[model samples]
Target: MSTMGRAGQAPMVVVDGVRKAFHGVTVLDGISFEVAAGDVVAFIGSSGSGKTTLLRCIDLLEPIDAGRIVVAGEAMGWHQQPDGRWVRDSERELARKRQHLSMVAQGFHLFSHMTALENVMEGPLTVKRLPLPRARQLAQELLAKVGLADKAHARPSKLSGGQQQRVAIARALAMGPEVMLFDEPTSALDPELAGEVLATMRQLAAEGHTMLVVTHELAFAREVADVVLMFHEGRIVEQGPPQEIFTRPAHEATRRFLARVTGGVPQPTGSS
Candidate 1:
């Protein structure tokens, strides 16, 4: 319900006191944040610290045990009834709500049997019921947007890791999501391959896509994020502008994390 944003517009995504658990182990604890339209918010933390889980909760790929996630003003996972009771939404309803957001995972989960263009066209054609010509056109445009126009006829196995990831990005974009969720999108790629995927993500940020990215790419976080959140033990311990979080982290956990990842606390990119 907190719509306050730097630009005075309602936020695109709101996660309020969200908590999630898996097999009796808490994964997300009291997580809350607001992603303003066009904001690129990066989440960083050690493995098992719950960064990816938070993205899953936001995408409704994993149900939160408590709290609410709202995207584009509609509650996800559950809806309130007239009698004041909260009820879980049906699978059909959840599918409809999922259209408001799209997620790209670490692994490029492309369909091996489909070409990049066919894979990108799958969502709009099947889920949105777009006409064949319209879906094809949209997929073509998105593939081009992600710099994969030439790879349209290539299958997943035929593409490089970076190219496959770019195709995955194009497929996500074909859905016309209001918010984009990235869960360690480049972690599975080699440095060279990761760079290409990162470049595509950077382009998305520049194009004003509201994004929530969970990543270990510290430089990307510092360079591209409007806000950087440091998660520890399933909680966000530090969050601020990238300069503050990267250069002047106030939390001990944050400092330790930076030291472990980058040898020591790194200064801002252009600092003397």
Candidate 2:
């Protein structure tokens, strides 16, 4: 493994020849992709197709057995030393490189004891070591951005599922991340509540945030994604602009998966 900043013209996030496995089962095989700044890319596939695993690898949440992950042009991995011993980079180095990325998971992972305001402020005040006053100010602004300003003082338990997920989004924003990753961010919510979370995400997309999301929401992917990746088994079988991938998929596996989940041709209608 090696670590270095991306050269000029490099993508914000790049995965090259990445492969991962658990026990003897492979989850991702020779996966590769690049996401430029402000791009909205969505990963769609059937369950167990490794969509979530790919997202996790990008964030270093799950270490890959082989491959290179570069974020904001910084490549991350263990480095070989001159003494014939492999030396891993310090955690502090990795932390510094990851400062500009944030992730929102399917399950809203909020601190139960903290109010919505505090939850959003924690990342800045703690990890970033920002001043309390400054953190609070930013937190409030982010909560407002997510349409949760009125629920700032409410604890996670007091908020609805949709409200909680919104707070999670706010918390991720507090880090001022350049790239945001969402792994099925709305999968846990009911239809009505899921709309609220998706609305917040749509707003982010409109504001030109670079985002990569793994989701089963085909309509949402079609509406918000600039590029759509169809993962089958353990690799990306097909990828292209949403219109092409959704309507003129080039792979049999992709067409079959889409047909099973979407029930025939996908209409050009936007997701509600």
The weakest ten consecutive residues by lDDT in model 1 span: 263-272
Please identify model 1 stretches exceeding 4 Å from their true place: 1-4, 268-272
**TM-score: which candidate is best?**
1
Which candidate ranks first by lDDT, i.e. highest?
1
Candidate 1 contains a number of clashing pairs equal to: 0
lDDT of 2 by residue, 1-272 (tens): 11221345557788888999999899999898888778889999899989899888777677888888888767665555798775555788667766768999999999999999999999999999999999999999999999989999999999999999999999998999989999999999999999999999999999989999998888889889988888999999988778888878799998898888877755554333
Q: Candidate 2: TM-score?
A: 0.91
lDDT of 1 by residue, 1-272 (tens): 24225676877888899988899999888988888999999999999999988888888888899988889999999999999998999999989999999999999899889999999999999999999999999999999988889889998999999999999999999999999999999999999999999999999999999999999998888889988888999998988888877778799999999989998746545522
Which regions of candidate 2 are displaced past 4 Å? 1-8, 79-86, 265-272
**Model 2 poorest 10 in a row by lDDT:** 1-10
**What's the TM for model 1?**
0.95
Rate residue 214 of model 2 by lDDT.
92
> Each candidate's TM vs. the true structure?
0.95, 0.91
